[model samples]
Target: MPRLSTRTRLLLITTFPLLVLFVTLTWYSHQSRQEEVRAELAERGQLLAAALASSGEASLMGGQFDELKASIYGMMQGDSAIKRVTLLDASRKPLVDVEARTSGQPEARYFEAPIHKRLLYVTGGGDRNVGTMGYVQVRMSATALLAKQRRRFYIELGVASLGLLLCLSLAYRMTDGFAASLKSSMQALRAADEEKRRLLQRVNTAVEDERKSIALEIHDELNATLIAVRLEAQQITALAAQAQPAPLAGQIGDKARAITRLALGLYNSGRSLVRRLRPEVLDMLGLQGALEEMVNQYERNHPDCHFALQAQGDFAGLDGNVAISAYRIVQEALSNIVKHARARNATVALLRRDGRLEIAVADDGVGFDPAHTAEGIGIAGMKERVQALGGRFAIATANGTRIAISLPLES
Candidate 1:
């Protein structure tokens, strides 16, 4: 069977037993009504027999058959339900028989009463029957009793049906209210989730824009100033080369050289910071070339640790959003490895597989348990960024730590 909703399930659970109870009660009522009808008819029969026996006592004793017949016929006329009224002698012989024929019907029910004569003296301080006179037998048809029961059944059926309908209506209203409440709650939750996603996406875009702006300022203004300072230092060294006093000239030359070295270091540091903020190469070279350049930079910076990049398929057509997320995720993973993983080697893999772009970064390092370690903001931000692009992000650590993320090729 197909699944039923809460309303339907509740209706079945609550109403099935009630239906059974209704049927049982209806049957009981029918049986009780039948019994009552039979009893009422029986009582009426007994009363009529007793009355006829009393009235016909003298006629029966005096052998007045005509008088006995007249009394029975009179009673039968008064009550058409009385099908037959028979008077019998003490020897059970029928002296008078009066029957009103009801053709084409089943045999009527019979009720009998014994006739007795009172003695002149009472025994045990009470009236006593001295001798048997005769008996009165009355037969009654069940049609009238059946008719009463039918009417009673119809009335009971109507009442029960009305009660059942009322109960079902109440149950339906209750279930409808409950189901509606649940649906409202679910819709509210869905709306809240959608709003949260939109907010996160906006935040990610704003942060990226800020990074790009800051990177541009550092690269264009700060690096230009540092380069000018280095050039001036070189000019001062050339002037000191021809100084009058040799010692003073050497001292001035050394100072100028030191200034030049310091300026060069500062300029290199600023460039590194700018690259970390936003690699300009990412915009110029696309994801695959930028990733390869990043790997080469890492290898040159940390020659003690091996770094490798393996990229398949052209990433020139990748969306800007996906490219940035992928690059940032890989950058974060590599930063983590450099800072924490006391490892000898690391690998970055970028591949297009099954219409999706998959990136995997692995390091042969002293892996720490992810469950025991709290994730830093960088990792959390990367996860959010990947998810914002409708991608999956996951990290695992065993013999080595591995971070993997996948984004749909469409975006």
Candidate 2:
């Protein structure tokens, strides 16, 4: 036979105890029934013995014994289960003997008969003070009792078997129902996870598209207009340098210097805005150049803090998503370091090993509990972006805060 399923095994475990209980009950019931049958048979035997004793010798001489014997014979004639009845004297000598209707002849001495037959012996009553007067040996066929007990046993067995089968069937149905519900719940959870992933992908795509469009607008409209204004300012400065009147010369020089400062500030602000919209250097000069420019700008802005960047291997052919995610992660990490780390020095490292890319941003700062500080939006956003690309993100602090991200080359 094949092994049982888990549900079946569990059902059997639960049912075994009940099975033992039922069997014990059935055994006790059978014992009680046997005791009741034996008591009934003993009561009938005592009644017959008392009736025989009440008749006495005068009734025996008046042919009353013969009539009583005829009545007993008539009553038991139809019952094939009554084999024979014999009356014995105090000395154990036979006084009367009756054979079943089927037995052709009676044996003169029952002692000469076969010893294998089982008999029931009832002592005939004489007086209360006297001992047993004589023995009434009755042979009873056990076939009827045996048949009754066999039928009862079969009925009990059938009922017990049906009950066990019913219990097992109910148990199986319950387990199957639970399993189906669990399977459906798991499928729903999986569908929800897939939906979230697709939604994130669409959001990322839309954001990138908007950034590209804004960058193009800044380059075409803003940069072009600024250049025209700068050229016009240069013309004004040249004309001022040639103008007569020595007193107006210093005023013209001051006006020219103010225009120069205003023009430089506008140009620098536009460039910074365009770079924030989209890092054009990332595409033209690759990841290394873009990272170096980003670090230089940050270091210049925070003169008191030291920022260092190191790169191993050329990432010129890396996928755009990989390059962009790495760059954004570094950008967000540096921003957090400036805003939260309170550090004097920070390091950003990028390395490619065994066809995988690893980015680490570390700072010698007053580190806080990661679980508590993870509420920051910048850190959370970086983690989401990295994970969306099937990368691993981790932040740890032994001596200081260190954020590490790793992504497969293919992704």
| Model 2 TM-score, all chains together | 0.54
Clashes of each: 0, 0
Residue runs of model 1 more than 4 Å from their true location after superposition? 1-175, 303-305, 353-355, 409-411
- The most accurate candidate by lDDT is 1
Candidate 1 local Cα displacement, residue 217, angstroms: 1.5
lDDT for each residue of candidate 1 in 1-411, tens digit (9 for 90 to 100): 899986787778888999999999998988888888678778888999988887877887788778778777777677656778888989999988888765323235778888887665555676667887999998876676677678979987998899999999998888788778877887898787777766777887888889989988988999999999999999999999999798999999999999999999999999889888888889999999898898998899988789999999778788887888898888888888899897899999999978899999999999888789888898898888876766788888898899888888783
Give the per-residue lDDT of model 2 (tens digit) for 1-411.
999865566667776888788889878877876766455444544454444444323333343457656755874675544546665555667666766665323222222121121233467733333344455555544345545776887798789879877986777788787656766787898788767766765677678779979988877888788777777777778888878785697688678777777877887898888888788889988888888888998899987679999999868799887787788889988998899788999999989887888999999988888657546888888877776776788988767789999987873
- Please give the range of 10 consecutive residues that has the lowest summed lDDT in model 1: 100-109
Find the 10 residues in a row with the least total lDDT in model 2: 109-118
Residue runs of model 2 more than 4 Å from their true location after superposition:
1-175, 242-250, 296-304, 310-314, 353-356, 370-374
